[model samples]
Structures are given as C-alpha cells and as structure tokens.
Target: MRELVFALDYEPGCNTVADALAEHPAARVRSLSLHATADRLWRVDHVTGTHEALDAIEDAFLTSDYYADCLATEDCGATQTTRVLDRADNTLVLYSDWERTPACDSVPHIAQDNLGDGVLFETRHEGRHYTWRLIHSGEGDVAAFFDDLAGAVGESAGMEVLRTADTTASMRGSNGTQSSPSPEQEAALRAAVEHGYYESPREVDVAELAEHLDVPRSTLTYRLRRAEEQLAKQYVAGRLVTDEASISR
Candidate 1:
C-alpha cells in the first residue's frame, strides 16, 4: 500500500540505489501522474530492485517535487529485517493509506516469482484509503517496498493536512458516495486553483483542465457527466427535469 507521484520525466540517476535497480532487467518502474480523488491529489508508483538495492530508489523520491507535499506510509511484511521505516524516510509513500492486506494464501500469486523472495503486497488509497493491489515480487523487492511505503505515508499525511486539516476525513459510501477522486486529481485541481481556473468566471477550458490533469478530456467529461447525472438523480430528482423531459430528448 505505498504510492506517490514523482517527475513524469524521471530517469534513474547515478546514485548507488538507482544504479542497482537499473541493473535488473526484470525490474519495472511505472510513474503515473493521476488526478486525485475527493481532494485532487497527485501520486507516483515505483517498482524495482532487491532489498539490497533500494537505497537509491528512496533517494530519488525523497528529492522529487511531490515529496514536499506528501507523507508516506510503510508496511513491511512479517519477515522484514529492516525495522519499519517512518514517514520522515520518504513522503511519497503517503499515497498508500488506502490499501488493506488480504487473507493469507497458499499458491504463488505471481507465477514468475523467484523462490528466494517472499511476496509482499500492500493495498493503496487515492482519496480515503481505497483498495488497489500491488502484489509481491520476492524478497529482493522488500527493501524498496518498505522504503517506498515510508515515503508514501509521510506524503499522505502532508497532503491531508494541507487540504483537510481543518475538516474531518470521512467517505460518504452510501449509494450517496460521491465521486471519490484520487490524489492525482486533487493535484491538478490545486494547479488550476493556483492558475485561477477554478473560478466563478470559468477561466479554464475543460480540455485545458484535462491536459493539466494528464487525463483525457473525454474521460474527465464522462466522469463528470456521470457524477452530474447521479447528483441530479439524488439531489435534484423530479425537480430539474422530469420523465417527460427525457422523452423530449
């Protein structure tokens, strides 16, 4: 359950940890700049290296732009040799507060998993700790995961404090559950707010907003359309338009 955002333009630097993770052909790192849920947040995810190779990965995230705005959460599997890393270790892990560990299993989840490495999995949350799975690789992946998680937690804390520090955090999950945006979405909204796009005059085009969001305008439109339909149904039922209006359309 570790997550956060980093430079979309990121490349492995000459750092020791980065060097090692780069050595592994199987190592995979995917960085996504997504729209934040509920509060408009930004998040990044990295997967790479053995436990011995993570010091470099940690270094990269600690210095990334999102680090200043996030608080990471860390969860080392039972066998973790390193004592749990705290938030100060990395703030990018903050994007992970939304995950939950599933019940134990017997079979290998990742068929290609190396025997020497025990699998570790952590769920992620974008808004209020929703459920998304990042399955385990092996013992080799542990160190980086823990380090990444610590960063994730710290980042999450920082974000929560910035946007909702004065307000209580809760998810309205009743069918009344509104669109729960991920941390990525929240980040874009912040940018728009700073740029004066989220204004009464409608300063920013929806497409511009989507570009700033790194998401398709169609996707955002669809989501908003759905949200509007739902809200209209729930809050504006029989008031805004009637069944006769639907027939007219």
Candidate 2:
C-alpha cells in the first residue's frame, strides 16, 4: 500500500469549522475514527481547547449546514447527527454522522469514487489547516483523488500535497502502528535541525527557515511546534513503558 498526505487551507467563510478554528487559534481537533462512503460519512473527533473555543465549535457543528467543505445542496433523505460523547475540563469527544445527498460534495465522497473501499483516512484540524493522511492501494487512484479533490474544493480553499511514499514496515511503530511526525511536520523539523535552528546559538530563525521551506512563517512555526509536541509525547510514553517493564521484572 501507499500513503498519500496532503493539506487543505480554507478561506474564512468557506468552511464553518475552519472559521471557528480561526476565531479560536488555541483550539484543535483530531480524528479518532473516520469512514466515508458515497452516501454517508461518520467520524469521531477529539477536540481540545478553552471553554470558549469548545463552545464555538459546538455551535458551528450544530448550526452549520455543512461540516468542513461538505456542502449539502440538496436534501434527499439526508440527515445529520452530532453527539458529544465525553467532555472534560478542556477536551471533548464528539461523534458525528452525516448522510450525503447527490448534490453534496465532500472529501469522503470523492475518495469513495476514486479510491474505493478499505482506504484509511486520518485528519487533523488546527487554525485554518486541515491535514489528511490516506493509506490505500493503486498508484493511479492517488492522482485521481487529488484531481477530483481540487476540483471539488474549487476556489473555496487551497490544497497542498505534502508527501507520497510506500508504506514500509519502518514507517510503523513498535506495536505495528503508524509512527509520530507526519510528513509535513517531519519536513519542518528536519529543516530546522539541519539549519541549526535548534542549536545553542541558532544559525537560522523561524523567518529564515520559513523562507527556505517556501512556506509562511506561521505555517512553518506551527509545524515545528506540533512536531516537537508529538516527539515529546512519544518519548515520555516509551519511558513509562520501559519503567513499567522493569518494575514487573
């Protein structure tokens, strides 16, 4: 199988969720589970932020006609449902299941048409960026999906292809799962390290690094920060597991 990673940038009014995120820069959402068919799409999302940010997101989900870029133009036995499964201090687990009509256009619907079944999708939403990682077969399907997705998005948002690579065993974790650091994040992190941005006396700053990567300064900074967070979490998790094993022994 091959893995295709890409990002979507939504204009202020193009996507309700993106709008809310732009308003609440501290909020973020990650897909826990996602599956899409031509007629329906369902996913469980984990959101984290301040109370105000969570409220904004809930309002957007409940009142908006479309989720993300899935615009519903016709109603043919279509239904949308959202439920908050869990809510804590600053985190919320939300489950959403929305039926797609013939006139609606969505990433999932496009994927179904081009990539077929058994395709895996992972998504993360922060600020105005929607990042997607898809794992599937068929080299031709990747191009098809990208073309269709771009057309569907049209002038509503910008799209960027981050990476495409064969799914090798080394890409997986010790427990046989996808590893941390997405393709985009990895690229940003590697660039910073190579440019001595992390050195005691930094040779390059974020602005310089951003210029080198040909991305906005804000975008480059966000990627590096997120990459650092992911790596730190993985390191802590690994250390905890080792300590547990030693205690058991």
Candidate 3:
C-alpha cells in the first residue's frame, strides 16, 4: 500500500478549525476524525499551551465561522461536546456533530472519494493549512484524488503534496535490509537519552517525552522499547557472526 501525505490550505472565506488554530499560536489541533452520518460527527483531539488558549478554543467552537458554515450548509444543526483528557498538559478532546448536513469540503471527504478504503492516520493544523497523512491502496488513486480535490477546492486554495511512499518499503533500508533502528524508533531513543529518561535522577519522565513528541505516553514508551530491542538484537547478531567466522578460521 502507498501512503500519501499532503497539505491543503483553506480559502479566505472557507473558514475551518484550522483557521481558528491559526489565530492561536499556543494551540494546535493534533488529530481529528470525521464520521458520515445523519449527524456528521467530528472528533477533534488537541493540545494547548495555556488555559487561556484552551478557553479561546472553546469560544472559537461556539463562534467561529467554521461552525457557521456548517450550519449554513443544508440547514445543518451543529452541537459540540468537550472533555478534558489531561488538565496538566492542557489536552482537550471534543466531538462536534453537524446534523442533517452534506459532507463539508474537508480532507476526510476528499479521501473517501479518492482512496475508497484509505485511512487518514494523522492530521495537524499549522497556520491556515492542515497537513494530512493518508494511506491509499496505490499511487494512481492518490494522484486521482489530488486532481479531484484540486478541482473541488478551486485553484485559489493552495494544495501541496509533501511526501509519498510505499508503506512496506518505507520501513526498510535499501535492498530490503532491516536497519537497526527505524527513523521513528531512533528519534524516540534519542529523545529518551537526551532528556535523561534513563538517568537515576530521571530528568524527564514518560509524560514529558510524550508531550515533547506530541504523541501519547504509551506510544512514546512503546517506540523506545522497540528501539532498544532492535539495538540489542543487532549487537548480539553481529557478535555471533564474528565468533562463528573466527572458529572456522
């Protein structure tokens, strides 16, 4: 399968949550999922740098043009439910449902038209642009999807294809070799080491690491453990191969 990652910028009048995030530098929408139903539901997961920023986000949900557009589209009824996942880190998770509305011109709808069963793995809002990671069955589908999306959104809104790669091949080195540590694994290991996660004094904990990586704590911990296992296995394999060669000689 192929994974195509791209960034799409909303037009000036096409207000979206991304636009709301652009207005708050201390806030970021980490991930979001849209469900197609009688009431179209959008589950948004986000992190804020401060309580004031969090309050601003809640206010935006109520007053932003994004929700107004949804309400205007097909006489949709809009409602939102929010929860505090982590008060200390300022993480907020919310679900917004637009009842009896047509699909908003959003990334999820674009993927549905193009990729069929493609999965949207990650989404982040930076400035006025929203970056999306989608996994498609093939390259051709992605290309077609891009064309269709451009046609739908018009030329005024900038669309940029940032990166594309085969899911299976991306994790492997050249010539199908298994590298000691994958890029993500290496990054997790480096962060852990640099932050003194391994030190007796423990300069940084798993929560801190997760915050730094913008991932869940469990995710960061899993990657670090996987990286350590890979490094250990590589060392043992190398030693075993050398010992066998010496014995033969």
Q: Could you say which candidate leads in TM-score?
A: 2
Q: Worst 10-residue stretch by lDDT in candidate 1?
A: 159-168
Q: Per-residue lDDT for 1-249 in model 2, tens only? A: 887877887776877888898889889999999988767899999999999999998888777766734743223345778889999889989888888776688877787788888788899888778888888875447788889899888877778886677777537543324367878889999999999999989999988999999985547766898678768767877888889999999
Q: Which candidate is the best by lDDT?
A: 2
What ordering of candidates by TM-score runs from best to worst? 2, 3, 1
TM-score, cand. 2 vs. native: 0.73
**Candidate 3 overall lDDT versus native:** 0.60
Output the TM-score of candidate 1: 0.21
TM-score (C-alpha) between model 3 and the true structure? 0.55
lDDT string, candidate 3, 1-249, tens digits? 887766666554455454566567547766656454333445556656467766666665655433521413222334444444444547666555543335445455556666775454576665455666777677347667788777756654567675577878755633233365656678889888998999999999988988998864534654676577767766777787789999999
- The digit string of per-residue lDDT tens for model 1 on 38-147 reads 22233445444444334445554443432212231222121111121333322322232121123211112221122223322222222121222233322344344434
- lDDT, residue 101, model 2: 71
For model 1 the local lDDT of residue 240 reads 42
